[model samples]
Target chain A: DAGITQSPRHKVTETGTPVTLRCHQTENHRYMYWYRQDPGHGLRLIHYSYGVKDTDKGEVSDGYSVSRSKTEDFLLTLESATSSQTSVYFCAIRTSDRSTDTQYFGPGTRLTVL
Target chain B: SQQGEEDPQALSIQEGENATMNCSYKTSINNLQWYRQNSGRGLVHLILIRSNEREKHSGRLRVTLDTSKKSSSLLITASRAADTASYFCATEPTGPGNTGKLIFGQGTTLQVKP
Candidate 1:
């Protein structure tokens, strides 16, 4: 609802295969984030980009990587997908002004690894 | 480890009744936020209460923060069937380079019976 969109809304891949989820935002926000949602864990941050070419790891970044080439695009990639990496992924963005702490989210991408 | 833990893993209420969800966090935070997720969709920002703020309101939602107890509560009045969703509490840790990185709770699933 925040002018955000995720590519391949749903994806299925075999174990050891590679998967990439894309997030695009039209709002020109400076901060973008990647997160995964699980039943008992709720949501955990995977990776985030504070600015183009600047990224950082999150709580669960072990198996995931992210790249932000431009202001509108952020990508999350799994080099070797595994059953443990199967989860619903979300992308969020916020303005850099720090006027408000609210983060807007994209529709999400559901990935299944066999 | 999750910074916040929500009480009453699930809640059910009549459409017209009020619903309250509580969240407790272990660390000091700069701000606490509430988000809602419907089924398999991404999270939607509901409201945010800063550490210095006691209470804030938006539409039918009211949030209160008690830094002394390191907890927060969200109250939704005049609930509707459409309000059925999972609510999560996230905290922005008070530290350096915290560019809106949030640690989330397990969430409370709310069902509003029509």
Candidate 2:
């Protein structure tokens, strides 16, 4: 499991509400990623952090934001949730020597917006 | 806006049969990785093949990369029921910068009947 845990394994929220998902890794991996899996779209990257306080947007980062205040915690927040934002979210970690990137994933969080 | 496309949206095979899935990417890649996802869980990294490598094998899994054709394939020999899951392909473009954040492909749902 790589010691990666995602909180709120399942959630149902109304549109226009704010939702936050937390990813915690006990292994202290250098890289953390946020991805959403939708039907027919596979999984799309939303945000990722290379290190603490070093975060970047992914392909689907439009309505999402992420923060990494500590080495073990990466937070993905939806400023205003939408129906389209409902999907299964996954967090992954990578530990490599600056090359040969192989990743480890967490058990996902399934979020539904109505 | 996906970088990769995996063939055969779904597949079904017997436990003793072999399973093969293909992936096609749009851009030159530094490496390609295959991952497996069980029902309602996060993905697990299966194998990785670098651009310089044409083919690699591990246990019952074999991965072949054709950079010129911008495609790759994953083959599992003597498939087991446990191999039933969704498989995804991710690519990292060949470059000097940080393109390590993997861009995933639409997955192939594989069902191995026992």
Candidate 3:
């Protein structure tokens, strides 16, 4: 998947548990994003990071948080998992070229909350 | 709230035929992008068309954007079974402090049968 890797490809967790998903990129792209995909909701952005230590919320940022301490790594944390959060999570890195304005995605992580 | 909405939630066609998908967005955008996702996989960036550009082509794929209509269309010529997948359109809104974030549509599922 475009040099982007998301850890814990599949996970089964219980409600109220804390979970953290990791996204790492080899290209050191400046922009990183976290998204969740559901059956009918399509893909909703959870959060995004433009630079190290710089992050902002997306349309669906509730119940989720993100951190980017370094250039290559972006982390998404679920403070308390809920059944509603069960879905496929994807990470993406925007291409460095401003003209192209394309994004490369990671393989994705499937999480099931029980 | 979703920024983009794709038409024809599901589509099926025979190989060698053509396939088309449409997406409409709510607001002005700097650029629009298309992505493809196979079952149980991450998304792959397909093509991007800037607001100023009306049309773009890549291999067997063609994309056209109409900023006045706030819509875009993707056409695949000579479709193959391997092209069966979900296609999504994402838009990067244009405005101050945009932060290069993308809003994606629910997607159109295409099934090209051989």
Identify the candidate with maximal TM-score: 3
TM-score of each: 0.97, 0.96, 0.97
DockQ of 1: 0.90
Worst 10 residues of 3 chain A by lDDT: A94-103
- List A-chain TM-scores for all predictions: 0.95, 0.95, 0.96
The parts of candidate 2 lying over 4 Å away from their true place are A97-100
Question: Whole-model Cα lDDT per candidate?
Answer: 0.93, 0.92, 0.94
Runs of candidate 1 with Cα error greater than 4 angstroms are A96-99
After superposing candidate 3, which stretches have Cα over 4 Å from the reference?
Answer: none
Tens-place lDDT per residue, model 3, A35-69, is 99999888899999999999999889999999999
**Ranked candidates (lDDT, high to low):** 3, 1, 2
Candidate 2 or 3, higher TM-score? Answer: 3
Best by lDDT: 3
Cα displacement (angstroms), candidate 1, residue A80, comes to 0.8
Ranking of candidates on DockQ, top first: 1, 3, 2
Top candidate on DockQ is 1
Task: List pairs with backbone clashes in candidate 1.
Answer: none
- Name the 10 consecutive residues with the lowest summed lDDT in model 1 chain B: B40-49
